[model samples]
Target: MGMPSHLGLDDFPDDVADEFPSDVKLALFRRARAGAALRLYRRRGWNDHAVRFQYDRAAAELAIALDRWEHRETNPTLF
Candidate 1:
């Protein structure tokens, strides 16, 4: 499926959708899109070191967001 401009909570798995707030979901979606954009930029030969670093950071942030959401969903104490 193609990337969406905005990700709704409904886009998440039912468990996740029920657990995460809208802001967290939006952040996860934005970071994912940013990372994807950076990847495309690098692929197009726009491989400046700064761009690469930003891409890496974005990717890391996206992973962290997902992890955080998962943790919140799985652990009642975290929610």
Candidate 2:
């Protein structure tokens, strides 16, 4: 079996999670911020459309970074 559809930084293989690519770092930062925002939104009882949109955007960014990283690892010559 391969990695799951969703993965946290710790779920990544090896030290790649620690010394990640710049894009991964950015995505992780955004994901963390979005997560924090979600918590704040919930605390304020603002479970609206915007909150969902932010969540989706953050998830997409992280997924993209992971895909890119996986591709780079598999086909190093192409990168």
Candidate 3:
């Protein structure tokens, strides 16, 4: 199998699938943020500072789930 294509967070509302439920989209967003952060940390050679930065940012994004929650709550019918 080939290495997967690079996926951007913007690739989808969450999962690139056309019909994800709001809840599933939010969950996927969190997972993707964390996954991306970890990858960035590794690319930085996992230096303590880089790891901490990536981990913290990812945690904050995942914890609050900023974009998904805000959009879903504020524009419940938009998407």
Candidate 4:
């Protein structure tokens, strides 16, 4: 479903989430520092507006994942 050279930040593999342990997944759920955010996009070879968008989206995903884990832990739901 993707090309080798097109592996951008948003282009992270779908299976990546499935591979990590829940604890490791929770680690990616933290808020990344600004420098880390920039470094992440740069490492992914992003620049310009695309870089900003990818950084914002990645942060949002992390926030959402953290919230999901929080809720799951409190409610003890099957996830």
lDDT of 4 by residue, 15-35 (tens): 756654374364454324443
Q: lDDT for model 4, please.
A: 0.54
- What is candidate 3's lDDT per residue for 1-79, written digit by digit as tens? 1111223345334334445445545555656766776777678776556556655665554545445655665687844
Writing each residue's lDDT as its tens digit, candidate 1 over 1-79 gives: 2222233344545565445566556666666667677778878888657766765666566566666756666787843
Model 1 lDDT at residue 10:
47
Ranking by lDDT: 2, 1, 4, 3
lDDT of 3: 0.52
What is the C-alpha RMSD, rounded to one decimal, of candidate 3?
9.6
Report the candidate with higher lDDT, 2 versus 3: 2
Per-prediction tally of clashes? 0, 0, 0, 0
Candidate 4 clash pair list: none
**Would you give me the overall lDDT of model 2?**
0.75
**Each model's C-alpha lDDT?**
0.59, 0.75, 0.52, 0.54
CA deviation > 4 Å runs, candidate 1: 1-44
Better of 1 and 4 by TM-score: 1
lDDT of 2 by residue, 1-79 (tens): 2443444656557655566778888887888788788889888898656876897799898898889988988888943
Q: Which has the higher lDDT value, candidate number 1 or candidate number 2? A: 2
Off by over 4 Å in 3: 1-16, 47-79
What are the TM-scores, per candidate, against the unseen true structure? 0.49, 0.75, 0.38, 0.44
Model 4 bad stretches (over 4 Å)? 1-47
